[model samples]
Target: MLTYTPAVQHAQPPASERPWLLLLLAFVWLWPGVFAHDLWAPMEPQLLTVIEQWRNGGHWALPTLFDRPYWEAAPVYVWLGAASQAVFSPWLLDAYEAVRLVNVGLMAIGFCCIGGAARQFLGRRFGRTAVLVLIGCPGLLMPAHLMSTIPLLFTGAAMCFYGLSLAKARVIMASLMLGGGWVLLALSGSLLLSLSLMLLGACLPLSPHWRYRRYYLVLPTALLWAWPQMLLWPYALYQADTAAFFSWWQQQALMPFGGFGQIQFDFSLWYYLKNLLWFAFPAWPLAIWSASRLRLADSDWGILGMAWLALLGFLLAVSPLQFQDLLVILLPPLAVFGAAKLDALRRGAAAFLNWFGIMTFGLLALFLWLGFAAMNYGWPLKLAERAVYFSPYYQTDVDYFPILVACVFTPLWLWAITRQHVRGRQAVTNWAAGITLSWSLLLTLFLPWLDAAKSQRPVVQQMQKAFDADAVRRLQAGQECVSVEAGNHTARIAWQQYGWLTLDVDNPHCRYRLVRRSPQATTPAAGWQELWAGARPREKREWLALWQRLPAKPTEPAKTLQ
Candidate 1:
């Protein structure tokens, strides 16, 4: 067995060489803020809605989405999301920030682990290169957003991988990592559980320790870790009927049909390859040549590479659901490969890589410019008028940003071919990688400005205006803590963010009050009022009638017994 130490310790870079590492670290921390100004908005409406239902003495049963009973989504994420809200009851900022911040922290930890672990498995120089590729990979960069659980999922997996590297040391510790990882996967859902366990079993050699020891500690620890979450699983299941509980996952699986499926297949598969090429850009040809130069049979890192590829293949094959973000799981291993190939590049192979890196940045800048130009200057004008200011002949559309960005690197690519005639290559490759890193930093930082130009819906802003704390408190103080009726999810978000007692809706939460808003219904208790408004005639009439019948606000507080 081979032993490895930290890269910083074994091969310390000069003080001047530290800027790239610092830049990567800084971006890792700030990346989430770029794409998502209101990171929690998309999830808040559903989760807060469910939480309000639970607080109203509702049974924790089938999950609900947008107020309707939704089953397929496992309760783990919902539970955690609600817990964050619960802790900071009556104020959502803390809870919202907590979930997003945790994810950001997790991404940083995962990146560092990949770098350190790669150094141990590969070599110091290769590990450094791997770290650079890991940071710069578009596949890894885009999904740092907090809306998804991929960050958590990747962090858990990284922990397991890094721990496996330590198996020769205390078996208990290594097994603990594996166990914790499996618990996370299980909580995530059956799909993740199946995939993770399959990979672990395939990659790991079955130890006599696990098989023979009646005193084994790993399994027990895992059970202990999972017990709390699993306790809620049965309750949720009992509450959900046969058809309602599995609906969310089924919906997720089926959503890939038609045009979306074709787009996903192309982007998820080809993008991963393209992302790798861009990460190493000007250095790519030499890296590829270097890779071709080596025989895998002699490479110590070969098994790890194969394992990484296998996991990626398995994920894509089995996921009835797929997205570009899901491909992040493949990044660490690819980083290792890229780094190793870079290490193999000779000193003469430089000019090509440098020019390539420069062009990569130049292209990225152009994309950024076009995205703005279309949104502000182009879209506002009539089509013919817009053509006067832009390249009208091609019917140039802004959505072609991806293609244009890809094209921008054409110059570096041309220079790369011509570099075969040049003698000095070392200076070029290093300068190119450095400049590319700078471009990545600038592009990511400027992402926030670009988001303003995109015409994405303002979901968070709408919620911010809709939630009213005082109204929610009055409602909670006046009515039953839980109420189930139409418009519960909307009510729940209003209540939870404002500290109202949860009224039951057939949301993710269990206990709910039954309320009817029809015209024939009796008057509401004091302080009760109808809040929903829409264009539907009958529902609108019902809401108006409910508004008139709402019970008067209570003036006196109810006495409580000690």
Candidate 2:
């Protein structure tokens, strides 16, 4: 065992002291009620309905909504969320909160893992600082606010870093983490880029040294991670859903979009560099300056760091989907280089970066004030009154103006602070602290109303009300009068909550049933009486005349089809 030296022991920071402050900020930003509940929440309920079915000793057939089973994607996330909810809380509220909490927790774990790996390479303080930067990274920050794939992506990346770090250890454990990391990545999205990195790590010319033994272990682990998709390939082929692009990556022939081969790109090849400037924010300038100095160092680890950056650059250039989140994988190596550079800087360089960060935030504050208070609160509202312009896909100048300004000002901020002077380190520290504090406070105030509007409250309420209505309950007792709410809105709510069991003529579940609008329309089998017809709230006035009559009583619970 490696003995824990006082020096090393001192090097490891206490959890509270080691940037737990960032966790609070992260929790605030990522917490629900601040952002529109993630669009993926509906998908969770869909998964839970299936899990509930299975728990009742039902078989593992895929779940159906609108009478169609959704079978293409893997069931891991849903199962995990459902099982977690079941364990923690039997209440619906508990179930919803559990999924959100677990996702947030996983992301926090990812940050910790990232910090740990950085500590291994860059000493303790710098590692935590890097994590702090990542927490505030605008690209990561926005996604972290949602309950989508970002948390899982963070977890998988952390796993890969950990596994690679362990390469200097015994083979079996390293293989498992490495394999597990790739599996997680596959679940989130493509594994091509990560697989390439691992392959390069394994096949480097420096093999045969003790240090390189870990390299060989990576290949077998990658092979293991790929087993699930490999096994599914035949079925996917028969289904005409083969992942042909991934298989053809080695052919060296570019596909419809530019690439090294059959691999296609959604954006142009230079996307990574473009997104990096915007996504990285204030830290990017520091990263570039740090990289420039490191390039001239000629040290072994410095060379390795450069190699990692080079690989990152290459992958970004070749990737099909050049989204900002992909640049996250670059943080680990960047952290190392950043720590080294920061350690070398006198107080002046640190101060400059700090001031740069502050100016960036100050500019963001001004932009938001003008865009929202001046434009959205003033001019846009007046226009909205005349035009009645509110749609789910609505975009405004206010929505993107700050993002544009952030993109342009970020580089200039870096440029102004390029020179080194170690004297201002204290000022730099104060500047960073202020940025983090201001962001947290501002978001706390700004997010709630936006989140409320974004939430599924109106939709959830309508469904809850309809299901709880006397008419709905009476139908559950097996009468024959059924009225489909006007428009497909209620049908959507019904299908999401009850799946195939819902019976409304407008709904596919009720497609085969005869739909009578009112008491005057039709007489049912004996014991069935038409009930008052009701339409969706917004459509009620338009359908008022048609819905003026009594509603129908439902029949014996309809036989449910698979």
Candidate 3:
């Protein structure tokens, strides 16, 4: 039998390359994609809407969108975002931008906790490698930068890992982390995940490696710490409004389990497995190699990591899978497990990863540059035409600052990659650098174009123009409210934010109504006249149309009385 060796036995890097330096690099990697852009569609706007509602004196216990209770998740993340916005939006940032800062903080916490876990499990030096593996994950990049609860969820999971790693030696600290992580997972709108972690903690004693006297205190201590926090929000919400509480309970707690029965036994069950190919990437390959070499009983941390991965994988398999559902939970365990065996990685594999990152990102960055040139200069006629095809209304203007930034980073990336040696940690570092460089280039070079395509500001602006023209015809002044019919939450929020229009979906008496429809769909339903029709520049199918209620024909004079 092949014997397993602790990762601490491997040669360590110089003191100059410390975990703090890796964290600093991670901070740099996190900021660019976050700061420069407006909230992009599908999720960011929805989160902002919830925060806006809360800020506008909506009840803290129940999160509402356009005055309707939204019970998809708990309001913990929304509350945090509201506080962040309140603190920062006054002077430093826009509302959405301010909320996004929470993402940065959550990711920072996640990095630290995961690094701490790695240090406990593998060795002191392996912490940096674990963090690098996480930073390099393609799955983490977009979600981490967005205004979503997933980052909080990721942080919570990282805390659980860190707490689990500390169970044998630091019982009190481990219990607190475990319990606190459970609360975070619950509050972040995933009760199921919180429960899973709790169960995982309870089962730890069953493992031969973790059957120590101190380990038994972990779960009960975690539970004692967690129960009050877990109940506090729900109980307050219930006391505030029973109906809304039940709605939230049904959706948040009961619905996840109910959803499993609804899932068909189809190819969709393999969703995480399929996406793991690109989502987990470098980490998954390394984790598989590590797992292959080590027995389940080899290390307590290894057992815990594997169990956590399996539990999450099973949960994801049975439950419905959306793009955002994968979050950062899956990556940290993989990183911990993978980082342990970094030195054991064969030379050819390390070199391949290094070159693969270089070649892939090198070409991608080159293409992104070309696309930017096409957007600004129309130098490459074909690519320029494609750009125009996507965003017809987007005008060509050179933003020299982003261009300069991208210009500097491109050569810097080339320099960094060329100088790096093909060692295990170096390979992972190269991958992380490549991801950061590519994402930075996209956010910098293509930000304007991306914003043009994704932002609802332009769409709302067009609707505003039409509404203004109609308002002028009616000789109305000041802001006028409009009722929305069939308009999505995104459009409703966008109208209020950009167009400064008060939207009441429940108001039947409002004169104007906004309707959303596919481009191929027929006219608005009877009694409303279409005033304006438009969609985002890149939106090919769906469009929003502004309509005014046709004035009720004056009742015919009472001829019968005459």
Candidate 4:
């Protein structure tokens, strides 16, 4: 018989060495980018638009964008965002910033749940190690701080994993967690993903490592708790608005299976596989090393992690891939597996990772600082010129506060790497700290420039200026509604929110029309005089144009007199 010993059976560390302080610092590092910038284009603005619709007396059960029901996902994140805005907008925060606070809370929950799961499986210290592994991932950085449902999805997965970890010992608690996690997954808006996870839960007993009788409680508890909670939202939505509910149901039912017919199967399969190279980063290599040290049937945690990873990887391979979706679902199991046997990692591999992190982040920090200097002081004329080339409208303004913060972060990172003994866990810790430092530098030292490139506020302002000039010429006062044609959700949201312009895209009576097009594209249907044309400073191929309808040239007076 092959004997298996759990890592938790090893000797415990002293209380002083607990990771509370490090976890706290990691969380603090996550705070800067969340609140320090304007809502960026593409995703953030789209989410904000939905929350705005909810807050502006739209149906609470249905998240709408531009007064139409948006069923791309469930309304859980939107509901939280709306609540956050309502709570914080009254006092000190902008609506967008307030809404983003949800990301922070969700991320914290995810970290804690992952840590808890890791502790149950590996040991106390490995819990912290797992969290650090997750924190160190390059892929987790952006999604963890974004205002989206991704964090919710991540937290839900973590909760389920933690529940699975508890199944051998704490059956009732595990049942609760499994049930709650299933509901959370459902709420995060992918029914297929939620059901896949549920299927994993069901098959837990089939694994030789998880054949405990208590494991049977998981599926029953999930059915009792999760099924009803999952149905509750749809039922409530149905009662509130039947049409909106049907739209949501149709989308939920069709989205996963429907897109397969259109997608390139080969490309879709390779997408996540290739992205895993950079996305999971250091964690994936560590996970591979950790997996090599264990047998599949030896540890329950191993079986669970491997099964979860396989299931999620398969899902990503077959489905249309979004980086956020892949990152949130895959990172937890990767983190757990990565940290499972760090102490057993070969010395050469640990040292390589240690030095690699130091060298990589050190060079990246140096480059970022150089760019910062170039943008502010014109020290490197070439870099300065390149910066201007990227964002021509960006003005160089030196804010000493961010500079001071960057300076502190750099020295602190150096101190951390130098002070740590180059063991496996310590190496991972250094990597996590380096990631935090680099992200901090980007958010702080480079935020203004990045905001200049990414934010649509400037574009909206330029349009406002043009609209004002038009108003002056026409002797018209007050804000006029603009009809948008072929414009994206980002532009529409930015214009309406920042410019305070009423948008009625369907109203033919509106005199002003805003259109988005390629730079080379001709005017959209003539009879309209161009009033404004502009794009974001960093946008190269596409631009927005405002057009005013010309009055019908007085109808030529009916062919004159006899």
Candidate 5:
């Protein structure tokens, strides 16, 4: 509570009380992205394993990625997807949509949290401004849609923001909200972030009237709310792993700099400045100006915003994987200051922003349209050749339904922009609408080609067809020795979902086994028959082959892949 001088005058009006319109708008903008493409490879399969574990009543804490125990982080983030999946599987919605919808919901709540925080100290108008900042920001496009840890972690950050904002009017509410939010933030693979937030709340400046509720009044209440974190994470950590587990665990979530294998920072100021130039977009400039203008004011709002922005910078500089994990946390806090900055802007600069949005997204949309045309019609031979070069398996078939849908959308977006040109709120509206329009075009126009190029589902299905019939029949007849792809997360998931194998019911060795690697990679051990081989045509690096045990063969054939 850094109430060094007095509260900022901008917050005289209450924080945003009405949040529905923004939520609805965000939904309309974001909903399609959730369903556009299949769960991507490399990461989603690993996350899905945890949800599968939770659904199957496995070790709740030690979620396995294939069949081996995976200890990247506790399964705190997976719990949401698991619960949603359990409630709506093979019934009301699809397995994928169920979890994706949960992510969208979290992102929506994050908007509200950011909006609420802005409203608390910056006034009601600024609350909406904060939302526009997030809505218009570039960093959130993919993370907001996917069923990854980032969306939930970001939502938890927003909740903490809201709780922190509630301090002046409702002490009890602030305490509970802040405490619960911190617990979730920590549980969602952000232990250090939670600790810092907890410390921030403890040190926040309070008005003279609000001083009585500072330590003696708020600490106990906050602790009660925060204490559940102990029951949830620390206790589970010990119970789930022995001393041996720490080796793999250290490489993952337990590491201070949380990268997959090692910590690597892109420490160049120019690198972040480049990211800020576009990633934070209009908001980054606004936040900077706000900081400059508010530098001398020791108001709680100014102090808090600077602190949060500074912390985001620190995290980006320090995190093992910069720009990826921390962007969601960065957007909301910056949005509050951004909102203030946007409000203070003159009409000319605002109009310039509107034009920038128009031309930028307009050109990008034109490029996508051109690409879509080249894919379907091949009039532009060079463009088509380039597309095919990247995605060799891409088959171009023009679907009229989406084309018609996009045709209808194009006019509507144009009309909306024309109206915004006449209206007072030009900057954020134009920016957000442009981004949405461009995004929608991509989703509607190019999604099928992307799926064809990227979806591992087809490859998985083909592998299922090649599964040795004799081995499968033996399994059905209660025989042993089913194949396992030891420590191979993708192969394990592909086989389990599309073939008859699981980590739980079988061991690693058997008559049949799976290996996922490049063609030049190692073959299976002695006495194995190469039955089938396949690779993602778009990505040559992803290669897989099946091997069958041939213990009784008179002579062992040289190791080979089909």
Candidate 6:
């Protein structure tokens, strides 16, 4: 017997690594109530109304906002919202809650896709790391929870990559993914062009079984059913509407593909980087490092991810990228790039990351908690004052339910901190755990305040009340409804909120009129008596002007109001 030393196998990992449980717990922590917060200004309300119009009309093609076709091409979320609204309409107070829950579900699915793909390419250790990169980014917080196209776009990007990963091994699944993923991308408003371009990018990165992929791609193309089958939501405008469409599109995509035009776009390269500096966070720094070592990264997935990064950059550079657009361009590839180098994290990097996460999120949680305590318990004098000043109308309510939920989750997050075995000893462990805590506390403890400050309800109510204490009564008594023009997105939101009291959406000569701009800057062509004017102080641009017609002049037509 040659030294029969009993080879002791290291203690086996748990029977179930419990991927589903971890993912679910993460979601539970990060995912807030759909109706817990308000539809924020700038994007949320505008997008909300677009979806509302879609569901209200029951037509498939994207509806026009104000009068022009929205042409966002982000129909997946709208369709999902419509479907969920159909199911939850009778019961739910806010149909957006259903749409929101669907968002959470899709979000969870996207996490699964990221983890699954990471497990295959980068191995089990980095699969969890991928999730950390996603949630830890501070920028993702608002965008992640928002009722906008970004959620689906982010999730779809993950699916597109995962589908690419499965292309070789699971041809049927790959075809389904490629087809379905591209369609979802196209449906995500104004991304159809991006979709077609990315498809070409996907093709350039060749792996084995190249011949089989052509067939895979072909099959999915059929499933797209671009024009004919899309009649369910057939929302495109006619050739006559081309001028308006291009005009709107031009605003967002300034000097787009500028090489084709004499108008050379600077691309705001520095500005884009500045935004990414904080928005992209550790992933941005880590991605830069990973990009430096691309040659040494895992063979196929690394290159494929790099290709995506290149494409996204090209698009962002060429187009006038909005801040929201970063969710699509920077994040997904950052996760991939970060995941590729997970195992290679030096002890120093790990320690830095651990401390960075611990501080960034830990302080965030503390500040949020302080704010909550200040509001509910009136502990901190200064913080409480600020909170009150910001949202004076936000009354404190001791809601037992969210408090109870927070009590459970607060300890759960603390437990997670100690339970290293649960998520593993990866560098990203602390960041993920910290973010989850921050999300949980913010949603549960600080939600009421957020709803007060952010929701359009108070703003709309105040504006209405300012007009007259019984303005609603006057409108309800079959009197003239207020005249509202489809102004900018901000005013459109107010218009939608106050639409019920309106005499007619198209009416201009109506006695009571709602003008978006200040009365002094531009008054009605027919002189008007300014009834009441106020604005949500939070947004300087939103100046709500309510006017009563002085007298009608023959020269002032409804079109003149334009």
> How high is the CA lDDT of each candidate model?
0.47, 0.49, 0.79, 0.78, 0.68, 0.64
Provide the TM-score for each candidate, comma-separated. 0.55, 0.60, 0.90, 0.91, 0.81, 0.81
Which pairs clash in the backbone of model 5?
A: 1-203, 1-204, 1-205, 2-204, 2-205, 3-205, 15-119
Tell me the alpha-carbon RMSD of every candidate.
14.3, 12.9, 5.0, 5.1, 8.0, 6.6
Where does the lowest 10-residue lDDT sum fall in candidate 5? 10-19
Put down candidate 3 lDDT per residue, 1-562, tens digits, no spaces: 9998767665545434555657657877888867666678667887888888888998888888777877653488888898999899869987878888988998898998999999998887888889899888888888788877778788899988888888877999999998889998888654778888888877777878888878788878889989999988889889989987776666556334532323232224466678888888788998988888787567888788878888877777676544535646788789888898887788888899998999999999989999998989896999999998887767676789988988888887787788544677888888998998899899888888888788878887777776456585452443455777643776777776776666767568777777788887757778888888888875667788877889778898766663
Whole-model lDDT for model 2 versus the true structure?
0.49
Model 6 lDDT tens row, 1-562: 6788888897635533456646665667446756656676556676667777887774564455655566552567777877877888748746657666667777777777776677767676566777767766767677667776677776777776676666657766755565556556655555444354346544644643334655456445535553333323323532335564455345422223322222344465666667777777767777766667667334667666666776667666655534544545456667867777655566577667776777777788779878988987888989998888887768886788887977776666565555443322344666766777778788888888877877767767766676554766777786657777655456556646654554355476577776677535544445787777766546565477778877656685556554
Q: Give the TM-score of candidate 5.
A: 0.81
Model 5 local distance difference test score: 0.68
Cα lDDT tens digits, model 4, 218-303, are 66865787788888777878988897666666655334543222323223666677778888877899898887888755888888
Superposed Cα deviation of residue 143, candidate 1 (Å): 2.0
The parts of candidate 3 lying over 4 Å away from their true place are 1-21, 258-268, 467-470, 473-481, 504-511, 549-562
Candidate with better TM-score, 1 vs 6: 6
Give model 2's TM-score versus the native structure: 0.60
What tens-digit string does per-residue lDDT give for candidate 2 at 98-189?
Answer: 55555666677677666666665556576656665565466665555443455666677676665655556556665666666666655442
Least accurate stretch of 10 residues (summed lDDT) in model 1? Answer: 452-461
Model 4 off-target regions past 4 Å?
A: 1-18, 258-267, 321-324, 467-481, 486-488, 522-524, 551-562
Q: How far is 15's C-alpha from truth in model 2 (Å)?
A: 18
Q: Give the Cα error of residue 276 in candidate 3, in Å.
A: 1.2
Residue pairs with colliding backbones in model 3 are none
Ranking by TM-score: 4, 3, 5, 6, 2, 1
Q: Candidate 3 has what TM-score?
A: 0.90
**TM-score, predicted candidate 6 vs. hidden true structure:** 0.81
